[model samples]
Target: MFQTEYEFTLPMGYIDADGNLHRDGVMRLATGADEIVPLKDPRVQSNPAYLIVILLSRVVIRLGALEMINPKVIESLFAADLAYLQDLYNRINGNGTRSLKLVCPHCQQGIEVELDQPGES
Candidate 1:
């Protein structure tokens, strides 16, 4: 079966107003509309970086116990967590890959390695 959603854990986690911490979450592949619609938003119009917040809110289906995920929620995330989500989004949305290519410092040989999220076994 084809998979469209991915699971992730924030590096620092999101803390709610009640002092609850949310670490685990789910993000789905982004659709064209997800990328396009946010462009029309005043926030995105004024600050292009705001696009990531809007874009993420649209694709992230779940986040711990939160009943809803929105741009405000995303804005509240720690910088590290927000970066994690961005990388995850790019990987699952066909904008990035799991493998990274590198050249050995000593041997000057090229090699490719697969990347694993922090907690994955």
Candidate 2:
């Protein structure tokens, strides 16, 4: 069976109220409702970027010792960490993978490469 959720480790990590660090977490595949309803949110309406925050908050079921997860918590993540999460989301939900490693037939060298998305110039 295909996996519906994936685990990731944050680079900077999230700090809880008592000073605990939360690096590991799980994010489930977003449902249709998850993506659509957030559009109605005033915050999302005012700022499209906030849509990721709200969507992630809904799908991220757990994060280390945190008792609850919410948009505020997702908003508090560092920019790099947040970008990492976004990449992870795209990798899992968009095409099931990001990059591939292959050996050059002529040079016998191995390299990792990412496929360009559609509409890229």
Candidate 3:
């Protein structure tokens, strides 16, 4: 059976204050309130983009040796890692396991693309 939570390795790991590199982690599928409740946060209201930062912090249950998963950790992550997680957040929550329907730009051929893997959009 499939699991609601998924494990992933960052393309570029998060380096903590102690200099330990954390590449392995797990994130759960976002619930409706997970996305909605953040809108009321002052941080989100002050800066719209901060939504993703907060959202990720909430869903990422574990990351390496870090006991506290907060926005600072998410913000400190490499751009590639952030992209990787965002793609994952959208994929699992957006369409489950089904491939997204699309058409080739050059060939104009219809295609089905699966964005199941981390960092794949």
Candidate 4:
């Protein structure tokens, strides 16, 4: 069976009004409508960057103990967390390999590391 949902951990995490920290979350593959609908949003129209917030809100099904995820929630994310989500969104939705290229500092050798989404052993 094909997998559409992916789990991830934020580098910094989100802190709620109650002082709760949310790090782990799940994001599903984005549909065409997810991409298209955000474009029509007035906020996205005013600020193109706001598109990611809307798009992410649509795809992120869960975040820690939060019962709901919305644009305001996404907007409240730290910059690092938002960037992490953006990369995750591109990686899964783009159908690209979940591998990252790196160069070993000690050996000065190139290597590729396969990234496993959270919840995987």
Candidate 5:
């Protein structure tokens, strides 16, 4: 898988009594190409809020910044990761779901359908 690394400096104002933010003075990290591409695209790059959310997620995961472990944050992160994975899978595999399973709305019986090959007619 392709990957890229980026370094960013946290501002001084974020330091707190608990500890200094980045006592080492530099934060360097790697993210998958799939994750970085969307952020780099000019169409979406101008939005700082989305960038902040992505940066914070990376910081939280890389720095192990849990003061008190919140399950919701963990769940949110997991969901974000899963969404990224699903996007990557769709791009690489040519479609999102390889197969579909259908069940009766009332009785919940299992049904299965297989997707066509990548270039199949």
Candidate 6:
């Protein structure tokens, strides 16, 4: 058996007519659930986001499992899921414009620190 819980609030923003940010409002995201069954397939593990979002929709919206498994949801799932994946990729590829590791000169011990910019200490 597997179980997890998450709770957070999403702040709302607006877009101007020219597509600029408008700081305002607030929104809440919440979920409550009991037991969760784990997905046991190795192939699904490779791209687990699709399965994850389906599970989320089913549990959050109380929608039928079949509706959560529909094609349109899966399509939206990929794009929605890519945000985190892309952040991971950027961090790995050193494209994050920040570095979290530094080396000591004398002892050569690896020190972990975050650099604000490419050349920042």
| Cα lDDT of model 1 by residue, 19-119, tens digit | 99999999988889999999999999999999999999999999999999999999999999999999889877767787899999999999999975433
**Residue-by-residue lDDT tens digits, candidate 4, 1-116:** 57889899999998999999999999998899999999999999999989999999999999999999999999999999999999889888865567899999999999999976
Candidate 5 global Cα RMSD: 16.1
- Model 6: what TM-score? 0.23
Candidate 4 residue-wise lDDT at 97: 67
lDDT of 1: 0.91
Give the Cα lDDT of each candidate: 0.91, 0.84, 0.89, 0.91, 0.42, 0.37
- For model 3, the local distance difference test gives 0.89
lDDT tens readout by residue for model 5, 63-120: 2344532223323443444354334334334546667798988999998977764445
Every model: Cα RMSD to truth: 4.9, 5.7, 5.2, 3.7, 16.1, 12.7
TM-scores of the candidates are 0.84, 0.79, 0.79, 0.84, 0.25, 0.23
* Candidate 6 RMSD to the real structure: 12.7
Model 3's number of clashes is 0
Question: Which pairs in model 2 have colliding backbones?
Answer: none
Candidate 3 C-alpha error for residue 42, in Å:
0.9
Indicate the TM-score of model 3: 0.79
Q: Write the per-residue lDDT of candidate 3 for residues 1-121, one digit (tens) a residue.
A: 4567989999999999989999999999888998999999999999999999999999999998899899999999999999999988877776446577999999999998865544344
What's the candidate order when arranged by decreasing lDDT? Answer: 1, 4, 3, 2, 5, 6
